[model samples]
Target chain A: MPGPGEFELIREYFTSRFQTGSRSGTADNGVELGIGDDCALLLPPAGKRLATSVDTLVADVHFPAGGDPYRIASRALRVNLSDLAAMNAEPLWFTLALTLPHSDPAWLEPFARGLAETAHEFGITLVGGDTTKGPLSITIQVTGACARPLRRDGASAGDIIYVSNQLGAAAAALPVVLGEVTVSPRQQQQAETAYYAPEPQFAVARAVEGYASAALDISDGLLADLGHICDASQLGAELNLDQLPVAVLAHSLQADAAVETALTGGDDYQLCFTVPARHRDAVQALQLPITPIGHLSEEPGIRCQWHGKPWQPRGTGYQHF
Target chain B: MPGPGEFELIREYFTSRFQTGSRSGTADNGVELGIGDDCALLLPPAGKRLATSVDTLVADVHFPAGGDPYRIASRALRVNLSDLAAMNAEPLWFTLALTLPHSDPAWLEPFARGLAETAHEFGITLVGGDTTKGPLSITIQVTGACARPLRRDGASAGDIIYVSNQLGAAAAALPVVLGEVTVSPRQQQQAETAYYAPEPQFAVARAVEGYASAALDISDGLLADLGHICDASQLGAELNLDQLPVAVLAHSLQADAAVETALTGGDDYQLCFTVPARHRDAVQALQLPITPIGHLSEEPGIRCQWHGKPWQPRGTGYQHF
Candidate 1:
């Protein structure tokens, strides 16, 4: 419902930059019709199911209300793409529903640039989007193609748990990102990079697809998300806290605080997955940057141990409400 | 990041009511996995293309902020489904991204019930959703299957344009809907019903699938939406204003005002489509309750004639910006 001039601006900044795949007459991108239509037409790849996820980021609630639009756009998309990675789905097409307080080219240009760059980097196409007037929030729905899907209900007792790369970087970076703390310039750069662009583990997902018993991306902290796998699979988990990969930025804190942040802080977007004992060797041979931090058990709850003593984190995860 | 209790509340109200299709263990629904997962897995029906659309409706901007949640939910979904109807698509699966001011059961209960009822009426399943803390708004992404798509760029110079059903009801009802005007209780009922539940033209879309050269739903009034067809098809439109099927509610106004409302009013949710001359007989034979209001022309802009004299409406359409 943007006015003529604002509509033109949207077309120029967003639609023009994403004029590839179906919109540009490409035959292999799965998009039959993209933007500038009532609905985007898509042909899902034959013999593969479509994996789809939706996430919304609200200004002030999820991220700073008037922060750098470029970084905000990057984080919004990367976090959503992480959902596809957890499902072992190869990214295909996505639709965006964006609500803005106003149409300002200064803010939009960088945001669209960041979005286009991320879409290109991930090899995904923007198929459709809606722009509305309101408080700033982004709702993105990502669709992907998957032959073998890793689901949360597939894990069994004794399955070995793994987390890709590391955790707590984004959590530790939040204070700096929010301008609440001062740090070295190099550390500031690292904080912004980790918070704004947590990489989606598509490669790890592909490697673990057929082998992992269950998988999910960590959004609401490791222990909290691990609890989801437990509830879904009707099992429990036992974590080795000493072996946890607390992120480098988090290492700036005290040893126990770093470990606690890795356990309970949110927004890391790493992949938390479980593999059966039989596939541990296979997954290990893949040599992906993953760590064996825990194992599923029949204890019916999540438990942690450090130096042969039981450990407990202060809070479980960030709560939305 | 809802707390355990709030998550339980969400699961009870929203998820429990939508326990059908894939989640209910029905293999024919094309849903491999539904809610309570990192992503929803779907198998698109063979030999059909997927048509998807996303729309976000903000409280106060799109509707009364504290109005009936049931009516709001109904209007939100219906408007989005109309996009699928414009593409000649049959309803399949959908995802919801909901932002709420707070987790109030009073609002969530009716909202979920209304959404469930509407989804049942339209035969669409809720496959995925994201709930976040923010200002109230609902973004629904609907996907459907279509054998043949109705596009905006297929109209020819001699194509006859038609509108399914009547227009101006929702626009004329806005005053009563917002409680800014006084009217009879029956009139108020009619007004609310028209505004809240504008029927999606699925049947009309099916009837015109093979015959309509170009099609789009009229959310931004006849002149504006038809201008889109003109722009895309590289043609103009000539309308016979006397033939417009203005709504009953709008007829209560003065003649010219009513006609103007029908021409420029938004939220009708009716479809304006074009059929080539060759398909006129076949389309007329379908016996739909549609009126031939206009035709495409070689000229480059929209023109209107009233009583054989040139005419112009005051405003072209609603502007979001």
Candidate 2:
């Protein structure tokens, strides 16, 4: 009658749904205990290592404060899933710590639905979570199983860099997401899809698992994330701007502007990985959607080349502070 | 020069400390990869189930917004560790999703040290985390290893209930913590320690592992949390108020007030467990710091008895929303 209290809200929206859902046979899925417990008990696959990552999306900082609850949920989970993919892991179980401003059923309904659908899609189960009252934010911790886990420090000087699919659509979609730009209905839909549902590169990760020596998901733009691989491996990289696979939405902008967006746009959720020369043929034989965009070098800093000439972007990447 | 960007801040405060510290041999400890990666890779103990839980503590709602960062970090991690103890799990690894209003080194320094010390104290490792910009909040997800887990659904009607250590100190310390009341230096220190450094009942959990039927950490309150065990096990409980191990700080209040606080005040982080009559002698023989508070009954609701007379407290526990 009073829209339920904290426990009731969790029960009605998350616990009941997850318990009765198709994936409720938790023991069969390595979950010995799940929701409605102090802690969820899980059994990681026998010989495989567990790959775990955590990410937090705060209202206004990560997304619009009053954005669509469904989309927000989708983005938050997917963004975290990307990290597992980067590690070349298979999706397993996840925990969500959701802090909300109030117990609004309107917000809870769609958010729960979105999370359930996404979890089902990714073959991940919502094992356990804590829901509290505070400023809206979602902290998702995902654990997966990996046999041949990809890491960011295995790259060598002769390794080539590649990225899955395209980039910059999510960054370009910001204008539309924030209502700063008016666009055609089709463009709006595309922008929303790109922004809310950027696919994690699980398939690419699997395709390049044995071949890729270093990898990470691009959440802080290509240059920034590539810098991570370089820093970890003690190497640098040289990007081939002509080989960049810019998203169509970003292509709508001026030529250089599109390249800048492709170079420095965060939230792409694309995999950026490195493969040694010996594994190049093997990786290419898989016919994956990934494109070779750069090459790790012994140099200590990132360099850019446009059509064989030296180049530099206007800025680096998104800054949290 | 610029107070370090996000990456540099993380490296300077967290990564460098954790890497060069005594726990750097991650592989020997089952952490294949720790911080500075897409994900933390871990190998769960050979035949043990993994118990995991997540908790989000917000500024103002959970604690004072501008409180000492060191104690805040300690409380956040210890609170999550309590869940592991409740499940009879040994602390393993944890991830922190910290949302800060800004990247202030002064705040980060103490917080990281506090977290590192707590991790060392609990024999846990800091696996991975995401630091972002937002209203100050800390979301901690802890994973532990367990052979025989204690679950709330295992209790039977005839099981005797017990609580570890003491209760009501944390709740009573709130006034002192918030500066609403003043006391002697020793009292103030005791209040702060009770409020901030709640010892997760891992020892108690281990002692009762084979004998206890069910258990959980007393977070919301003795009455409310025991209600959880009741709802899960489909049984009720009659709390013997006279038997409660009222905390020393709480004893400063009136007799009834101390009992009431011990009954309904929360944040004690003590374990409440049930054991069948058959295991009573074995448990008592262990001589653990536990007191028999009540017993499970065939009834459907929680009942309280104060010196053989029914009693009701003014409030149940802390309400989140």
Q: Pick the candidate with the highest DockQ.
A: 2
Model 2, TM vs. native? 0.97
Task: Kindly report which residue pairs in candidate 1 clash with one another.
Answer: A1-B320
User: What TM-score fits each model?
Assistant: 0.97, 0.97
The residue-by-residue lDDT of candidate 2 on B1-321, one tens digit each, is: 345678888888888777621223445458878888899989889999899999999999898987898999999999999999999999988898999888889889999999999988998888888999899999999999999999988899989999999999998888888899998899899989989999999999998899999999999999889999999989998888889899989987334588878888888999999999999999999999999998999999888888899988888777777
RMSD, one per candidate, in order? 2.1, 2.1
Clash list (residue pairs), candidate 2: none
Q: Compared with the true structure, what per-residue lDDT tens digits does model 2 show for residues A1-321?
A: 355788998899999867622223346459878898899989888999899999999998899888899999999999999999999999999998999988999989999999999999999999899999998999999999999889888899989999989989889888888888898899889888988998999999998888888999999999999999999889999899999999989987334599899999999999999999998888988999999998999999899999899999998898887
User: What lDDT tens digits, residue by residue, belong to model 1 across residues A3-45?
Assistant: 3454686698888988654434545467778888899888889
- Candidate 2 chain A weakest ten by summed lDDT: A20-29
